[model samples]
Target: GLIGKQPSAEMERKYSNETQVTPQTPPAFIFTCQDDRAVHPDNSIRYYQALMRNGVPSQLHIYPKGGHGYGKRFTFPYTEQLQYLLTDFLNEQLSK
Candidate 1:
């Protein structure tokens, strides 16, 4: 929406997660849905790739369905699976 309304460098830096990814940045566990239309899944994918290149330990999940707002609300069909992923990732990170 903001991109379509008025594009700017500041907006891009703030809104684009990939822009903030760096080698020294903390690791992340990212998830996205295949059917998310509001924001293309590339955002997450790009960020994951950046993390990998930066040698950060990261996990990514692309659900078969769900959408942009599927997080926390747990309203999607595969929300249970996503929860499992999040739990596993957190456990592993915490143990390390």
Candidate 2:
């Protein structure tokens, strides 16, 4: 039988809470948007800082303005910025 799965409220809440807890340390790139309203950008900022403090190779970009769901549908100065960030991260990771 094909089973349809939907996230239970408990699961959803757990995931949401987990997002708030920054990783102890991250060894790779971390990307975050400053103007993101849905998820406070501070979480990413703190995580990136933690990575930096631990001597991990990481970078973060905080756009002046780019609301949530900016995905590829919107065009703003940050769009180009995010593109370059992604490209750079890929190159760095693949080179290793």
Candidate number of the best TM-score: 1
Write one digit per residue (lDDT tens) for candidate 1, span 5-93. Answer: 67687888888878787888887988888888887788889999989988899998888788778766756887777778888988998
Encode model 2's per-residue lDDT on 15-77: one tens digit a residue: 542343444443455555677767777766766666666666777776667676677666665
> Whose lDDT is greatest here?
1
What clash count does candidate 1 reach?
0
Q: What is the TM-score (0 to 1) of candidate 1?
A: 0.83
In candidate 1, residue 56 scores what lDDT?
90
Candidate 2: C-alpha lDDT: 0.63
Q: Model 1 lDDT vs. the true structure?
A: 0.83
